[model samples]
Target: MLSSLAAGFGLGLSLIVAIGAQNLFVLRQGVRREHVLSVVAVCAVSDAVLIALGVSGIGAVVTAVPWLLDVVRWAGAAFLVGYGMLAARRALRPTGAALHVETEAPPAERGGRTMVATTTRTAAVLTCLALTWLNPHVYLDTVFLLGSVAATHGAERGVFGVGAAAASLVWFAALGYGARFLGRWLDSPGAWRVLDGVIALVMWGLAFSLVLPVFTG
Candidate 1:
């Protein structure tokens, strides 16, 4: 049981540590200090739920319906493309002023631009949800891959799933909270432009990868 748990934790962390759209969004939010807790909770909880489904043998059902992934693949690609365009726009037309990190400033004092760097809690949460749920690779990694690995543990699969879920929580918490330290560096518009530019490239790259398989396969 201990060995299975350890394996699950290690594998889970490895899968999630990759540079992906969801991770990039979380990092951006963390650096902006905008809805960090909500974003982290959504990501971590969503991973746990998906991991639970996989361990419960739902992966078999998902596999049985190949069309389900097809639909998800197209939708994910579309969403990613749209998001990438938005990021590109931000990068190309950067706000001249540095991002305002001091949240205590009055709306008037902040040049009446409270909405510039920060977003509402609802928007933040919804974006986080879309980024998490709309990515087909997430299902492949957490549900199918992780589930298949857990099955090898036999009766200890449950413990393995728990370990995997725990890893998700730990990773997201550290990533979301730890990114605040980079806030000082992202204070300049040029820095923000570079970050958004990188985000746009990654988003479009993921989108293209998602669709390329359909045409190539």
Candidate 2:
């Protein structure tokens, strides 16, 4: 049981600690100090739910319906491309105070621009959900791959799932909270532009990778 728990924790962390859209979004929110708790909760809870489903044998059902993944693949690609364009626009023409830390100043004091300071909680939460759910890779990694590995534990599969879920919570908490330290360095609009530019490239690259398999396969 101990071995199974350790294995699950190690594997889960390894799989999740990669550079991806979800992690990027979380990092941005963390740096901005905007809805950090909500974003982290959504991501962690969503991962736990998916891991539960996967450990419960839902992976087999997903495999049986091959078309499900195909549909998700296209949708994910489209969403990523759209988001990439937005990021690119931000990179090319960032607002002067866009990356400034939020303050209690009124809109008039802040040049009568509220949107430049921070996004709505609803928007942030929705974007977080979309980033997590729309990506087919999440399903593949959490539901299929992780599930398969958990299955090898036999009767201890439940423990393994618990360990995996725990890892997700730990990782997201650390990432979302720790990113605020970088906020000082990203104070300048130029820095934001560079960051957004990299985000745009990564988003487009991931989108292309998602659809490339369709063409090749």
Candidate 3:
């Protein structure tokens, strides 16, 4: 049981440790200190739900629907590409003030910057939801792959799922909160540009990967 728990935790951590859209968004929000708690909660909860579904054998049913995966693949690819373009634009023309702000400032003092600085809680939460649910990779990794692996654990699979969910909580909490350390450095517009550039790359790269599988398969 101990071994199975460890294995599940390890597997879950390894899968999520990769640089992906969700991780990047968490880091971005963290740097800006905008809706950090909500974003973290949404991501962790989403992962827990997906992991539960996988362990419940819903993944098999999901994979059986090839057309569904195909549709999600294209939709996800389109969303990523559009978002990547926006990130690339931000990289090209970034304003540090627009990306960062201390909430203590009065709205009038914030001026036009207020509009940019105030990434509404609604927008942030919705974006977080879209990123979590729209990414086909999330489904593949959490549902199909993880679910299939959990099946191998037989009676101990529930324990494995618990361990995996715990890992998700730990990772997101660390990432969403720990990003503040870099906030000072990213105070410079140049640093934000660099970060945005990297985000654009990751988004487009994942988008391409999603599309490639369709053509290749």
Candidate 4:
């Protein structure tokens, strides 16, 4: 059990450490103090669902459908590339105020009289789901990849899978909440620009790493 747990935790941590759109979204939300933990919670829960599905023999179904993997590969690659472009564009844009006070929009102009601030919460949830689900790489990693390794342990695979899920819950919570403490620094336009620029570079680099092998092959 202990060994299985260790394997699971290590597997989970390794994947979560990588910089991706989801982490970038979480980082920005943390800085904004906008339902940050909720974002983290959704990500963790989504991962847990996928991990559970993988552990419960759904991996065989995924493995059987090579087309599914291919579709995911292409979609994930495209999404990563697109997100990288957007990040680079944002980085090049002039820095703006860190926080903007909410303004009341005129009734007809508001489109159904919805508060902009309320809409941000919905956007956050949708973005979290899109980040988690749209990236076929995530399915490959959490399901196909981890699933294969966990299978080696036979009956102990369940224990291992649980450990990995726990890691996701803990890591994202820590990353999302712990990062908020840096909000003071992030409030500075120069600091935000530098941090976001670094993030953009890292995101683009990861995207290249994902798609480069296809051309090289």
Candidate 5:
């Protein structure tokens, strides 16, 4: 049991530690300190649910329906491409910090113009959901691959799944909360531009990943 648990935890961390679109989005939100908790919660919970489903043998059912995977692949690619374009636009026009949370000051102290960030709490959460759920690779990795591994554990699959879920919780919590420490360096618009550019690249890369295999195969 302990060996399977350790194996699950290690594998889960290895799979999720990649520099992907979802991780980039979480890091950006963490740096901005906007809806970090909600974003982290959504990511961790979504992973947990998927891992549970995989361990429960539902992955077999999902893979049995190849058409559903096709739908998810196309939708996920479209969403990623759209998001990547939006991020690229932001990068091209680098702006100052978007102050979503403002302090109430006197009219004289405060400028008449609202210096709000383009992203809202609702939008941030929706984006988080899309990034988590709309990625077909996520299902392939978390559900199908992990499920197959868990099945090898026989009766210990439940414990293995729990360990994997714990890894997700730990990783997201660390990433989402730890990103604020990078604020000192990203204070300038130039830094933000670079970050946004990288995010755009990550998003487009994920989109291409979804599309490439279909054409290649």
Candidate 6:
């Protein structure tokens, strides 16, 4: 049971450790220090739910539907392309002073408006949901793939699944909150542009790789 759990934990970490769009978004949020806790918590919770669902026999259903897999593959590829384009645009666009949270005055000084403060939290939650749900690869990774793997363990399946879930929670929480160290270097607009440009390249590369197999085959 322990060995299986360890294997599951390793598998989960391996799946998530890639420098993908979701991780990049989390890292960016960590650097910005904008709703870091909420963002991490939402991401962890979402992953845990999906991982649990995956281990609960949903993998069999997903495997039975090959079309679902194909749909996810194509949709994920397209989303990656779109995100890459957006990142490129940001890199090319002139740097404007976006609202830095630290610079904001107290609500009383700002006309007693609660809208901006509330909106940030709302946006953070929405971003987490969108990031979790939009990418079909997440479903593939957590539900279909990991679930299938856990099925073979029989009695150890529960332990394995829990281990995997723990891994997802740990990784996202660390990435979402622990990445603040990078903020010292990336606080400047120029640094942000450079980082975004790299992200764009990575996204485009992954998208191209996804489609390349189809054409080559």
Candidate 2: deviation at residue 165, Å?
1.0
Model 2 root-mean-square deviation: 3.0
| lDDT comparing candidate 6 with the true structure | 0.77
> lDDT per residue, candidate 4, 126-186, as tens digits?
8788778877778878888878888898999999899889989888888887776775666
lDDT of 1 by residue, 78-158 (tens): 988998999999899876566755446653345455436446889989988988888999999989999999999999999
Q: For residues 124-193, write the lDDT of model 2, one tens digit per residue.
A: 8998998899899999999999999999999999889888998999999999989978967886788888
Count backbone clashes in candidate 2.
0
At residue 98, give the lDDT of candidate 6. 32
Per-residue CA lDDT of model 3 for 1-217, tens digit only, reads 9887888899999999889999999999887777899999999999999999999999878767889988888888898898899899999976536444444655344334642454688988998888889898998888878888999999999889888888898999899889877756875678888988999999999999988966887
Q: Please report the candidate that would top lDDT against the real structure.
A: 1
Deviation from native of the Cα of residue 51 in model 6, angstroms: 1.6
RMSD for each of the candidates: 2.7, 3.0, 3.1, 6.0, 3.7, 4.4
Model 5 residue 110 distance off true place after TM-score fit, in angstroms: 13
Query: Against the true structure, what is each candidate's TM-score?
Result: 0.92, 0.92, 0.89, 0.79, 0.90, 0.80
Worst 10 residues of 3 by lDDT: 107-116
The model with the greater lDDT, 1 or 4, is: 1
Q: Global lDDT for candidate 4?
A: 0.75
Local distance difference test values of all predictions, in order = 0.89, 0.87, 0.85, 0.75, 0.85, 0.77
Q: What tens digits encode model 5's per-residue C-alpha lDDT throughout 1-217?
A: 9988988898888889989878999998887777889999999999999999999999989878998988999999999999999999989986655333223533222345444456788999899999889999899889988888999999999889988988888999899989877867876678788888988888888899898989998
Q: Sort by TM-score, best first: what order?
A: 1, 2, 5, 3, 6, 4
TM-score of 5: 0.90
Better of 2 and 3 by TM-score: 2
TM-score of 6: 0.80
